[model samples]
Target chain A: MDNLQTEIRQLIIDALDLEDMTAEDIDPAAPLFGDGLGLDSIDALELGVALRKRYQVRLDGDDPSVKRHFHSVNTLVELVRQHSERTA
Target chain B: MDALASGRPRLHRMTHEKPDGVTTRNTTLIESRGLTPPIAPGRMDSFSLPLAAWAAWPTHAPGCAAPTDSPPPPGAVDIAFVDPMLRRRLGPVARMALNVAHRCLGERTGVPMVFASRHGELARTLAMLHDLAAGEEVSPAAFSLSVHNAAAGVFSIARHDTAPATAIAAGDETLGMALVEARARLSEAHPQLLLVCADAPAPELYQDDITTTESAHALALLFDLHQSRRLHVARHASSGTPSNSMMSLPLADLLAGHRPDAAWSGTHARWEWTLDDA
Candidate 1:
């Protein structure tokens, strides 16, 4: 879980072009949008594409659960872990 | 010249005296290819370029050796004034344009802007086209910034400015036309206008069709109608040689005070620039 969290953090920084921030700067439990990371819809879409490409995880655009899943780095880690376990 | 009576516009007889006590009369007679007559004297307040910081640019000019070391990447562009998140989305050309425009405008805002480029965002456009051809989803950021006016639009957004902005693309005449537009805007309520011209080399697939010296470059010129320097543009017989890659190179030289006057031939006309003592 720790390794996956670090990887996801780095991925977010790189994929979103968060140039001034590092992986450690993003709090794992903090929100990823609105007031926390301040990412907007375009960034969300770009991040979704990047996450899909990297993890090969299934993501449905219309899934209401996606909003909850992307709430924080921890939630994203959990979602990815479950997806990987189910596929494995 | 009889060519003047061949149904072609004649060069208006005008003599301009340079600050250094040199007087020049442009005798090249041809049609007025673009905005003509009553060119109000305009002052160039400032200009900027990121590529000028390179130690030495790769040159194909005869008798000039290419640099031994690899050319430096585009110079440090300090756009700290802009929001970091928004800055991250800018490509090289857009970054260059914005950086120069900011430097030229300084603290001024709500002024009209004109952005000219021969091939605007060619790399981004090409990438989006390739993605489409490959049946892949095009990145929304790339698609939005790939438009010709994206630079100008981003400038307005960054400044939170409500002034009108125009984007122009006119082959080799891009800068000339942009100047004409800026000149026209000087008479409006806003006497000062910002003009930014930028271009990057076309992608390899289109390189054969496009010609430019540098891989990419951008220049911003702040023009005020009250200043003394003037630029006269008129159509000239097209030289048979293939056009150079960067149109702003000569203008850059003029702005840097290296030359009192400079002239360059474009696709359909000649541009003569001079600085005069008011």
Candidate 2:
């Protein structure tokens, strides 16, 4: 996994209080909602705020595109990378 | 016992060793003059909640009789039994309540629950408020868990309890009101229920204006109306007010064969609780 993907994995665990799991435990390609990691609406919103605070990765929860980026850790990394490139 | 049989009110002084080690004395006046007859048929304003089993965290009050069944589990509850998903989200205070709740209702499904906390999730709420004031977006997870009834909601989800659950916060008299609510709901439709009272002190900013428990603790009681020991609660409008009902201790102290007078007065009515021997 890329450093950014690993960082995103750790962010998800810390922001969601998944204390029992480590960053390595989360599969980058696994779905984060209903099945794979099993997060919910609240966790999604919290992650959005955490990313904005940490990496300045702005995300509008109501935007249809935001839903797609939250599908997996890989998608979140892509979203963060795109944002940083735009800012750079 | 003889003092109450006669029409005499007794004034007893109790010193509470706050978790911070500061001692505060509260003088509880047990006034039973000419009030014994009302209990013969049982007073309308008062109610009897028969308890089946009771458990509390950190059973170390000033006058608590040693627990008979076994010692209470430490501050952190046994999480081996809790779902990993739910266990992670439970704050320390929530864990305190859940630990005792699980103890009283172990493996017993569908039991109705009453969760009472005087300052429910105050710490979380205060943090969110600070974030908002700083022009920062608060964590949605914190907002969701800051509701007064969040403890009950989490417990129901963790246990998959389909039965009724009510969360209560009644200022200083939170425990009394919760017991009253439990009594009204206990009937043939629901013969028994669970009552869990938990509270931690308000954040330091509000602590000066708000009287709070020095430490975080929770108590759980399994109530069955038919039990031989009857809990008699009498409501009286007070002329002079009393201190906050050390919600964590007074009742638990009474049950531990320690004190007999755990009473508190709300605005209109004060509740006097007397646990009678079988």
Candidate 3:
């Protein structure tokens, strides 16, 4: 995994209180919600807040363009990269 | 469930020897006048029900508990027996509350619960406030679980028990109010309900306003409406002296059978609990 993915994975673990998990434990391709890692809506909001604080990127669950990015950790990594590049 | 078998205090002594404050009472007399009005604004409120089971975590005697400010953080209660996924959202008070509630229920399910805490997650709330003050967004997970009823919410979710769950914070009378709520909810259809009371110490910011040493503890009592022996709860006009004691401590003593009767004082009234001989 890239450094961004590792960092985002750590943020997810820290924010969600997934104390027993490590970056490697989370499959980047796995769906973060139902049918995969099994996080709920609360987890999504929590992850959003964590990402906002860490990367200064706001991924609104209500926004159509950003909702797709919440599908997987890889998508979140992509969102953060796109966000950082846009600001740069 | 045998409470003594679970390493709780012996009930044998409770019925045999009277503790300093608790006296053996005739239930018939108290039942006849439960609703008798007091001379003041808040009247007498009393409920008597048989206790099916009782449990408290951190089995340390009340006064012995050190403040949560030391180490292990707010969420670091690794009791080892709890499930990881279910435990993620629980902090110290919720963690201990859920443990004792589970102990009271064991394999039993669907009993509605009324959880009480004097200061529910004050530390967590204070931290969130600090974050917001620094122009940082508070944690969503922390904010969601920081409510007064967070423990009850987590308990029901973890058990997959959709039964009604209520959270209560009534200042000094929190534990007593919860017992009353459980009594009101108990009926023929639901013969039993659980009362779980847990408290962490007040954050230092509010400590100066408090005169008594705050005891950090959690306890759960299972009350059955059908049983003969009763746990008599009574509210009286305040003893006039303010009580800074944590209500759950005396309650733990009452449940452990060390003290058959315990009372806590509030500005308007004083709440009392007594155990009838089984």
Candidate 4:
């Protein structure tokens, strides 16, 4: 879980062109959008694309649970882990 | 020629001056580089530099020639004033426009803005098209930002300013048309208008169709209606040669205190521009 959290944190920074940020700057429990990282709808879309490309996991844009999956690094780590386990 | 003969807004001229008196308001070239300095007149000599250097070129080398890399990237754009989250999504063209616009606004808010570009968001549009061709899902963010008015819209959102903003693309006459739009927006109530003209070079596939070498560039001009120096624009016959958008070059020269009338041909018309002291 720790490794996955760090990897997802780095992915967010790289995919979003967060030039001033590093993986350590992202708190695992903090929200990825709104008051935490201050991300918006565009970042969500870009991050979804990046995640799909990296994980080879299909993400349905209309899925309601996608919002919960993107809430924080901890949540994103679980989501990726589930997808990886399901595929494995 | 037939288009002109068919009464397509042909040979029209507009003059703007303060009705109350001969007011001399400040006209500042807020932030610009490359084509702003007086280069050799009558040629697109400034396009030879990399897009990043357009506004940074020294005035001492007026006509110094340099080889430009074909299909140069949209070089460094310093738009640190914009919020990082929002700024990260902006493409090169938007970054260029916002960089200049923010510099010109400089603490001023609630001003009307006119953004002019010959190929607004062309690069973004091309990228989206490629995604579609590859059977990839076009990112919703990219699609939304690919519009012509995306820059102006983003600028308004970033500033939280609700003042009127307009985007224009009129082929080679984009800059002239944008100035016309700015003049129309100016009034006694809104004495000043911010005009930004920017363009990124067309994508590599379309480079062969380009007439003159174009490099990415953006310029901001602050126009005060009460200014004593008035600009006169009139349409005339074509100069009998193909030309690209180079209005910003002469505009920069004029801003640099060169008191000379200039003329340039666009795709469909010839425009004669002169600045005179009222």
Question: lDDT tens string, model 4, B135-176?
Answer: 987876788888888898889888888878888776666787
TM-score winner between candidates 1 and 2: 2
Which stretch of 10 consecutive residues in model 4 chain B shows the poorest summed lDDT? B45-54
Candidate 4, overall lDDT? 0.67
DockQ of each: 0.47, 0.73, 0.76, 0.58
State which docking tier applies to candidate 4. Answer: medium
Interface RMSD of each: 1.2, 0.9, 1.1, 1.9
Clashing pairs in 4: B33-B54, B33-B55, B34-B54, B34-B55
TM-score ranking, best first: 3, 2, 4, 1
Q: Per-chain TM-score of chain B, candidate 1?
A: 0.72
Give lDDT tens digits, candidate 3, residues B1-278. Answer: 76545644331211323222222332112111212222345556555767888888666564335644231344545444455666777778788788788888888888888888888888899999999999988887788889988888877777778888888777676776677567556666788788898877788899776655676678888877656567888877554776766777776777776765887776556778887755
Worst lDDT run of 10 residues, candidate 1 chain A, spans A50-59
The 10 consecutive residues of candidate 3 chain B with the worst lDDT sum are B26-35
Q: Which candidate ranks first by TM-score, i.e. highest?
A: 3
Reference-based lDDT, residue B92, model 3: 80
Off by over 4 Å in 1: A56-64, A85-88, B1-75, B237-245
Q: For each of the candidates, what fraction of the native contacts does it recover? A: 0.50, 0.89, 0.83, 0.78
Highest DockQ scorer: 3
- Sort candidate 3 into its docking category: medium
Q: If the candidates were sorted by their lDDT against the true structure, best first, what order would they fall in?
A: 3, 2, 4, 1
